[model samples]
Target chain A: MSLERIKIAPEMYEIMPPEYQDLVKNATYGNENRGWKDIGTSKELIEEHSLCAGCPESMAFRYILASLPAPEDTVMVGSTGCTSLVFPHVGIHNIHSLFGNQNAIATGLKRALTVRFPGRIKDVVVLAGDGATVDIGLDMTLQAWFRQEKFTTICFDNELYANTGGQESGLMQKGFVAKMAPVGKTFEKVRLPEIARESGCHYVVNCTVSKPNLIEKVIKNAIHIAREIGPTYLQLYTPCILEIGKNSMEGLQEMRDSEKPTERFAYREYISDQAKELLTEMAAKEKERKAEAKRQLASVKA
Target chain B: MSTSYQVLRGPEHFLPPAAASMGIRLPDPGQGHIHGKIVSEEEAMEAAARQFLSAKVPTIFPGPLVLWAWNEKAAHKATAVRHLYETLKASVTSTQQAMLIPMPDYRPKYPKINPEVEINPNHPNLTIWHNKIDACMFVGVHCHQANLSLKIIRGGTDCYTIAMCAQAGHEDAMLSFRDATAEKIMRLADWVKKLKGSVEPPK
Candidate 1:
């Protein structure tokens, strides 16, 4: 096909599977800015605190926090990036620390809270930039994974340092050039999911902000794993409009389109359901094994 | 077998007295089982000053190495060490080993201008733009500089000779060190610089 003919039309929603398109349409329709409905039980807890509504990162995070099942007494640890803006807005409690320190701080917080509250707080969610996690923060992030700290790290991989004027981050895909790499980037793109897996994170998820359903599923899974398995790493494909050279609307669209291939198969929902089933089975197996062990021990004693 | 070490005061001293604050605590120097004597803050300051005056080249580690550059006055070695240690500890894993070195007083040597060379005042999203710029500059400078050092070290005459001559006809061996160093430096620097000037910076 000719390049001109291949151009995507503005009105033509890309041809996705019928069921997938319907799901997208429904999800978008449901997102009617009913800010209150999205605000889960944590609304009351964070209502009194001054919201960091100014920054987009914070806005996105607040949106997610609102949707979470248990956001009560949750302490947020933000790195030295745009996400810190949410600290002021949430009003309840937060920490603004050094660059790439969010994961470590969140790890510590998760450990402390889980011990103190003992199943009261759900998970300590760390919001950081791709630069923080994949690059400078990699060691800390990897360490948290190895330690299996009970926390969820959400890396807002905008691919560039949005807070710092679109600098390329470790998460930036190959073939992309940044100001620092005017000559061109030399290192291969760092794949966060692969790295997280290598770092021993029991659950690692990659999703984009455009796929709210998928993002939500991944986030929910991460939270569940943080409660059950330990620490979970989630790399979120957050597009930086200013850095990624896309207008706000276009950026949002790109993010949405990025998920098209994966969404076609309803990957998020399928994975979530599968995980739930697997966990249930595992638990049953564990109980049976324990019972068998006890029976053998009693028999030996007799 | 007494190895001398200096104590640096890290940025943890500046952490707000809030529950959420990531505080700094000294890992019992004994934890690593290194038989080195931990020096006091004053001794560390003196040693750092000497190292700075001697023009000793500071080495960069593989992962993130926290360095304290005094923006205004000459930062004490102890202060820089403490900052680097706390920052590293708070950021990296306790198990992940990194060289925590105190930054020599660069302020007195190089006048501190806003290191950010590029700014986007007219960005459609002002808030996002400013934040991106700040983060890029902060991490970009260190990452870029570290990469540069690695490249120079690997591409140095001795390294080239060892690869090219010692391992004759081994193109892979000859190029490995130089290529890896160059790749790391260029990649990190490109990311930083792009964030500084790009119209649509990465999120």
Candidate 2:
């Protein structure tokens, strides 16, 4: 037997996936010394999938994947459009599903995993575009939430059917000229997070991939909360560089100023009764902890 | 961390999914069209390569597919497609290299290559000149890019399209090759460049 002394990064392994050492790491969620305790070592899991430059969907995808505590225990159900373009090439177990059926497929897969490998599946996420999430599969998505199925649903709202030459979708922002909506979409934009909350999701957030860290922190926390609670929903306003017709990064920046832009990473967490109770308990414990520290200091001084 | 969002401020729950379709048909309706074609890998490569090798004014359409399949991870690409153009430009005769057309969004990764041409969907009568091309080679793009090549095919340009995808039959692209990697794409780029200036047409 031959033995070789190869160096190992125990700290990096403790923080992130060991194989992700070569990636450009960001201090998003944790590592106070480096940054915060560290949310799963900011690594790009989606390798070699071409969308566009400064593509917000790609940014969100990387952050979401990095948030997972155990990627091997995760399975994703992805729907059609630009989102589907890259699913086949992802490193994790993924299903390149039909349009408007991301949630349905996710539900079925989760149920199957539950039956076959009980308590084995930790995460079952549905990543879909607005065309699928709002116009096409909205019913299936709502029903899945209503059923209280334990999963996280993220809607990458680029506001139009981007992959098919900028057609108007139900989720599109008003006044955008497109192939299908020449004059502009007349109907108002639908509020997805509100619907998800009403449909029984325990954690519903309306955020964007504008700031990498906020989205990363929100997604990481949302996933953890969704596992402990019921269904969780996030409407991440990721931008489409192609639709914007600008350089991808510059386009994302343009969103920050547009009359009705899309690059905003806004996080709204809806707490449930159970979560509220837990928070209350935590608050009480924290108070006692502070009081105990004060008394100990006083006694030592005396 | 706070970032700017310029749309409606709050999340709203409004219209139900398919309010009218609920009575008549399934909520989520598909086109009932799932396209699947099985072309032998050798056959696809032969047809695509032959057309690419023989053309007088061959047009190269490098889509997100090429970026997805071929771009080296730490290379100097404005997009993932920069290297393919650089490789092609490096290998081919300068006159031959000038005819390549990249999607408008993709910029050149390296210094040289007759500046990349951007194709727009809404251009007036693109089909007129689209008819003039001898062959269209598609690398790592989806239906949108293929649709442009299809225009040339529709123009009675007998030459077929050569599409390189992550997998075969994923879309309507006529030629499909599965498992395309950066190395494979680079090899293909080199081959296309080397084959570009050859004087004789293939038998």
Candidate 3:
């Protein structure tokens, strides 16, 4: 987003809301090096969200928004769920089409954007709930990958439909009792990251929001691969605290417990040859950029 | 008396104040109501039809979902929305593209859906009030955008607003119809047609 787009006219500055002014003056929209570390330090892309107080999805939104490599040129597509509640608060451009059609919308949007801005990188990212990704819109999601749509798809796998009274979702684990699954889910959890690999996603990662640094890396990798290679996917296990019978503060601990090395949500990533090469080159460039910046800082100090 | 709609409430105690601080338009959060009321599909449709018949100028803002359903019901849904507008003699307008980012030639024209032109959500109330529209219906809009737009309208103008959603109805709309299938929209069209037949059409 262009900072100029959000700038309030000087004549109307006193009339504008303070929070909006704060957003315009302090938001980290175009910072290349911004990450999860800027969560509370700077004005975030998401001014605020309406998610449950301790919802991990809320935290995931902040991390992902903060970690976007090109916030100025990125467009987010969201589906109907708790995630939708927060998109209005997000400062970046976003599309909330029909539920479960996020991937399809992103496919067209990415193509349109590419045509509109030739030779420029305009990232299209799809952020949806587990139900939208794995259950309701699974066919479209998979089809988008099969078609090799150049975009990133991130699923906030909260197990059940938390926004809709905790209904049973395909991402819900086996033998987990939910609203529809009164006797517990009878089937195994769908291995979406592996399916993403098989469905032609160039980069795939399965993890939780347990570590901010890892989340930042995963999001950047997914976006970078999709921009140059093909579709990429990130599955983040953002558990629903209320559904899991946990209180507000237990959300982070729940994610941490689920993502232990030996546990179900262990951090996993699969990178294709092209993606690996691209990442390596990009990493070297990033290192060089940092070193140069540090040298400039030291020279100034001297 | 039995209520036709369920009032949504946050599970946590602090969500109300916290959501408020985040600029969230709390719609009937089960304590003190902030925005509009949640009504049933029939109630919402009836209110919309009545508003259309009585208003000096009525408008229909069809969202993308109204143009196309997940099940490829776009043609039929568009037809029904068209029939509703034709029956009520309402002007039609919509947000051209779902994305809010400003771009040149950005508003992709969807004249097929009968919207002569599109308006941006950022200045929703100004466009509505400028057009002198007294009542408007939002059909097939994504819920979040619909919620934001509805709140902006409520806050700025006195235009009666109705939201017809495919999923659960929006609480922020003055009237909201949930499970908005093509047949349901056709039903609303018929109801409006019947109402228009009984009353003098708006000038």
Higher-scoring candidate on lDDT, 2 or 3: 3
TM-score of each model's chain B: 0.19, 0.50, 0.65
Candidate 3 per-residue C-alpha lDDT over B1-203 given as tens digits, one digit per residue, 9 for 90 to 100: 22333222222122122222333332232211212443345555666777777666677776544432323465567667666666665322231111111111112222211112444454566556566666777776776677766667766677777666777666666666666777887888777766654554444
lDDT of 2 by residue, A5-29 (tens): 1111221122222333343233222
Could you arrange the candidates by DockQ from highest to lowest? 3, 2, 1
DockQ of 2: 0.02
The local lDDT score (0 to 100) that residue A61 gets in candidate 3 is 88
Model 1 ranges with Cα > 4 A deviation: A1-59, A262-302, B1-203
Q: Which parts of model 3 have CA positions greater than 4 angstroms off? A: A1-4, B1-203
**What is candidate 3's lDDT per residue for A114-199, written digit by digit as tens?**
99989778999999999999999999999999999999999999899988898889899999998656899899999899999999
Evaluating just chain A, the predictions reach TM-scores of 0.68, 0.75, 0.96
How far residue A114's Cα lies from its native spot in candidate 2, in Å, is 1.9
By TM-score, the candidates rank as 3, 2, 1
Proportion of the native interface contacts kept in model 1: 0.00
lDDT of 1 by residue, B1-203 (tens): 22232211112132212211212122132111101223332332233222212221211221112122222111232233333333333332333322222211111111122212211111111222222211111111232332232223223211110110101111111111111222333333233233322222112
| Candidate 2 off by > 4 Å | A1-43, A258-267, A277-302, B1-203
Which 10-residue window in model 1 chain A sums to the lowest lDDT? Answer: A1-10
Docking class of 1: incorrect
Which prediction has more favorable TM-score, 1 or 3?
3
The total number of steric clashes, by the backbone 3 Å criterion, in model 2 comes to 14
